[model samples]
Target: MSTATPQKFEFQAEIKQLLDIVIHSLYTEKEIFVRELVSNASDALEKLRHLQLTEKDVHDDNLPLEIAITTDDKAKTVTIQDFGLGMTREELIQNLGTIAHSGSKQFLKALGESGAKNSNLIGQFGVGFYSAFMVAKSVKVYSHSWRKDAPGHVWSSDGSGSYEIEEVDGQRRGAKIVVELKDECAEFAQDWKLKEILTRYSAFVGFPITLNGEKITTVQALWLRNKSEIKDEEYTEFYKFQAHAHDAPRYRLHFNADAPLTINALVFVPQENTEKLGFARLEPSVALYCRKVLIDAQPKDLLPEWLRFLKGVIDSEDLPLNISRETMQDKALLDKLGKVITKRFLKLLEEESAQRADAYNEFYAQFGIFLKEGAALDFTHKDQLVKLLRWESSLTEKGKTTSLADYVSRLKDGQKEIYYLVAPNREAIESGPYLEGFKARNLEVLFCYEAVDEYVFNNVREFDGKKFLSADHSDVKLEDVPQQGEALSEADVKDLTKWLKDALGAQVAEVKSSDRLVGSPALATNADKFASPMMRRMMKAMKKPGEADEPVKVNLEINPRHAVIKKLHALRAADADKAELVAEQLLDNALIAAGLLEDPSRMVARLNKLLESV
Candidate 1:
């Protein structure tokens, strides 16, 4: 058998292109080649072990089911051997020498479409065995089939488009891939370097992997076992090992679902949000896996971008297991997986909030902004995300927060709107004029402290039949409270508004007596039927191109009950221009309170002019 001449075959054109990329551009990190070779070895071993149970007699049946590695730094070689199902002569030709027979053409087409970015998709394709060529000058595979009748073979390749398969006698079951390292890849032959790669990527392999005489893969695949059987310390240890995190998990969701897809997810919320402390924005660290092998270490689309703060593993057998993220051939399937996982995570948060209030609150305190972001951006999960939002309301004391559910529960019988005010802090919202009417009407207003709240509420629209209404909005009309010390007749109020409108000119859309204002002299309301004044200002700040620079035309709503209006009615009659300054000053102050004031320089000069008159 050793004298049998080698039969040679050329790789298909597309396979040649794939080989070139694998050797040059497919992987950014050279260490990954070690992972790919070992993963393939493990798969072969698993296949043979499965065959052993079904068949009464097997070739080399008693050989230990494990992977062994040996390094020869002086000889510049590394060998990975597995006692698993090996290849017969025909099997070697089909597996190692032929690519057109495999699905390599389709794989190459996908690579061309996605370009170089998604090389991470390689492992999913089951073609990872080729990755060894990246670090190798030449490769030789020695194998024997699990079938006692089958003869062993050796496949040799230099990755120059062709491979040779020859009969080799006295071969044990499974394959041993020997890589003669390229001059530049000599480091892979070092015992310490090879061990590091094996430990980092292949540590949890179901079968034991030994580097020389020392074992590297010792950690059990905890994600596959029942959660009840696992100890807390074990989970913590696995998380630390998987996520490379120093702090223990703040929250963990380890669940197995059979519906929609077969999934085993171990998701964790970190003990602290690093981004909240001014660190770099967290990348999508949730490593995706299939069975026990990793798919993508950080798949950006596996979960929504807003979930970047989470760290864990989501292993789904239902996933296609072999496709680029950008051109996920089964996009609908992937989307279904994403939706299911996101829904589960949201449900987990809801459960925590209900059963473990303080802990959930702590998590919300650190990660609430991400939830708000998802609410504003991901319409698919908008309604669910909105329910998850938490903030202090005008009725709640400092640091105390209420959810939309709680706010909606307390709404009055006829209250047709869910009121909210976006302010910098609790002090700002309380001191601002917007809350006065809501407070007087005994209606609860959600106090939104984040800058993005304005954008979020505008899109959230409503909850439970109550339309979202910003307390600062101009069109708000609260039920009138008992009039307090007001002496302005309707006729006097009409004349004052008409004159003020003429004086303010283009700045005022329509000046009228306010129904929403309780104590303020005047308030600026948005004239745009669709966008509020605050919305317009936000749009402007975003530097939306081609938008008009025309000043925001606001309807000036004046409170007839306020002492300032009572004085303003006489002041206008006594001194016209002096009254004009006070009118503009009152409008500017109202604008400032509404969080719409931009250029305050003119307001300062006008205030000084009013001071000179006094």
Candidate 2:
């Protein structure tokens, strides 16, 4: 009798193209191949785990269900073996030799037809097995079916064009992938490299991953576990491991959602905000996962950029497991997932701020810029994010913060606007002429220190029907203060105002007797309708050419009752030139107080002239 063997077959045309993409351009990092193979092994073990729950006649049930990776640097080969549900000879031929059975054919067809410029689809398409060819010169997969009656088999392929499946003896119940590493790719066979890759990409995998006989995935997938079961210490450890942060988490949210999407998330706000230390704006560090398998370590669009300070894991089971499993096939679903998580996170923050004021304040001080950013840019959740913002206000002591809701609650019965002033510090704002009028009227003004606060407030025009108005805005009209100590007669005020306007010329848009100035001699208001001191500084910092010396007109308001202005009016009539110099000096001093002076060099020279006259 002639012993004839089954025939080997060449790869399909689409499979060849798919292989080329997988081996060359599919994944940004080549180390992902280890993660892919380990993930596949974990899935096989998971299947057996489910099978063990119901099935009684399981083959080799005595063997522990785990993935073991053995590397041989000398031989330039790495073997990933899993003692779980293996495949029969026919199953091997169908799963490895053919493209249709592996479900990769449809993915490749989609890739070719869609012509999507970004190839983030490869990992999500379920062809992660082919990622082996990225570093392997040749691969041999030895598998045996879990059925006691099924025979063992070996599938060998160089991934050039063809593959062979032959019956092999003494194979284990699960699959084992043996990759002969290319000359330049042998670093994967080193124990240290494999362990690092496993820790980074697959540390939280449900199944145990062993590298060179030592288990590497010691940390559990806390996001997948019941929140009640996870201890605080475990959470801290996970945060440290995932976020690479030294300090413990200031706040954490462990939540699961089923309606919008099946999501399991464990998110953390670190104890310190690194960006607050003037580090670069943080990129989104939330690791994206599907069923405990990592999809993207840092997905740019997974969450809004404002939530970049958040660190942790988000896992969704609804995600389709594609070939590479590095990205998602359905973008709409991913976006929905992102929105759901973001909303839930925002809700959690609201709760934290309410329940733990001191802790929340610490977190807010470090990470509040992100909330301000969201308020300015992310329109979908702007209202909710705005509510979470806290600022130093006249109602609160220095370094203390009050929320917009609190600010609204403290508003007087007839107050129509929410007032805020952007300044360098609380002391600066308190000592400025703008706050004097507000303080006289007992009106609260929010103190903003960050440059972005002005932009944020502009975008958030109103909150809860109260318009946000800058305290220093020229358009602000304040209640008239009854003459308390002294008064400038209507004629004297009119004469002084006329003389000041003529003396200041174009530098003063319209000098007038002030209703807002309390003790100060004068105050400068921005003449440009759309620009404030903060806005001007932001524009200058952006280095828009020819913008530094951009002329900004100002409306100067002089306190008619102040001694300096009263004496200056008399000095102007007696000595016109000296009064003009004194008037100019007073205007420049107000501009400096308003943070509107672009160049102080001229002010210093003018001061020297005044000193000589003195």
Candidate 3:
């Protein structure tokens, strides 16, 4: 009920400028107005809570500390009311008429200067309230001051240039904002739309919130709560609610840190990796929040790209957000926060691997590719990510894995390089010529079965001071092992290599007698120092059709002690034509074993020719 004639006043010049930005460009999403208003409501509620501790005389003392949002499609209006610290007529003018006089901005400045009073109020720039003009055709604020002596007032604005204020009676203790939405933005007046925006941005606000008399904020901000008091079932429920997950998480990291930056994080590793199930690339699921209000639901810069599979919440009180709160103003601070989180997660993994080996192994089996991705691309956390990677080696039985640190621990005396072989599977590696020499010399070779393994190792390069060396690489030189059988003389080997080199021409980069071959007569290794055989095959596969591929040339290493090499050495002089066909067929066979043969047409023809000579 109005008690006096309305007094109209022109908006302060700075506020008019700010209103234009808020209405036209300050925010990318128009629905952000709801988030801004709700945050302000939360802040007001917090102030009233503090006032209750000191002041005995207050208006609307019986009102609960909560927020109520009501939307009416028929009227095309949204009403949001908070029973918190309301404003007097002069306070309203000071807080709303001028941009610089924002109570929240002053509070923030005081917090900055006084070293953080124990408050979680999030309105920092004081410009959030103006965001309502984005959708509102007319706005009205009804407020009653907390002091019993102060009178209630209603402020009205069309956000054009001027506004009116009227003294009113029977007003509540806090503020109630009614937004008469524009015709084009009438969708915001729907209950469903408002509910969605509220649930997304304000679900975890400290105070209770209700929409049309029904409770909206049911889930607590579990990340901010102490971990010791949280039960496992509560965690599972929160995970299900936040992640929209059906299966319980395999691992969860809940931690709070104060140094460098204040952070509260709850991250989860799902029981299954959906990206591995042939789904589209996972988007960043770890939402970014400030003081429990969502800043970005899928903030690309909050976490490294490799952590896209992780799903949960990361809330920080230390964020310095812009007026709109859509983006962070300081990228360096965000990066520091991300680093802290990544390191903490890796530490959790380390502890899990040490204390619960079986569970960690199971998690690794499901999500190891993501760690490999991080190890390859994210240099800042690569060392920690590398330590968390797991692989099955020659010494380990199938289905069992060992970490890079464990492999380093078991390094043979005088072993200077960590050896690994990339193949399609353990069976392919065990049956191939690459592992024969290492196995015979009692050296362990890690079995890498994924396509990304070689690329990851290439990027990682080394771990624990030992460089990673591919077993099938051309330049790899293994220490001398005592011979078990008769071998070709040095002179005989030189002659055979010269003849084979000439016979194979451009196909063979070089031909030499090998110390790294035990049973196989010959094997092909890529002569290119930059790319492995597997990497070359992958590159060829990815190349566009009709694009010419570079010729495949390999260094052919022949086992001098094998009967096939000795027979080929003799046959070259006896039957020149037959020896040429045998040599070509041998190179094809080696290429097939290395998974480098894209077409076997020439090999098929040469096999028939060899059969005819026999």
Q: Could you tell me which 10 consecutive residues in candidate 1 have the lowest summed lDDT?
A: 116-125
Tens digit of lDDT per residue, candidate 3, span 1-614?
A: 99999999998776776777668876999999999999999988998899899988888798999999999999999999999898889878887886556644433344345433323225732458888999999999999989889999999999999999999999988999999999999999988899999988898899999999999966899998999999999999999999999878999999998998899999999999888899999999999988888899998998899989899999888876656777565678889899999889899999999999999999988899999998999999898888889999999999999888889999999898999998878999898899989987889999998878888988998998999988888978888898777988999999999999999999888999888898899999878754566687788889999999888878999999999988888998899989888888888888888877778998888888888867
lDDT of 1: 0.80
- Please give the RMSD to the true structure for each candidate, in Å: 4.3, 3.1, 3.0
Candidates' TM-scores?
A: 0.86, 0.93, 0.95
Candidate 1 TM-score to native? 0.86
Instruction: Tell how far residue 501 is off in model 2, in angstroms.
Output: 1.3
Model 3 lDDT, full chain set: 0.87
**What tens digits encode model 2's per-residue C-alpha lDDT throughout 1-614?**
11236458787777788888888777878888998888778878888899889988777889898889999999999999998888887777666666656666767665655423223332332367888999999998988878888877778899999987777778879999999999999999999998888877787777777788787856788887898898999999989989998878988989988886788999998877787788887889998987777788898888998999889999877775456676556677778888998998999888888999898888888888889999999999998999999999997888899999999999987888999998889888988899998888889999999889988988999999999998887888888767565768899999888888998888888988878888899999877745688788777778866655567788989898888988997897798988888998999899888888878898898889888888
Comparing 1 and 3 by lDDT, which wins? Answer: 3
Task: Indicate which candidate wins on lDDT.
Answer: 3
What lDDT does model 2 reach? Answer: 0.83
Of candidate 3, the 10-residue stretch with the lowest lDDT total is 112-121
Residue 222's lDDT within candidate 1 is 79
Clashes of each: 0, 12, 0
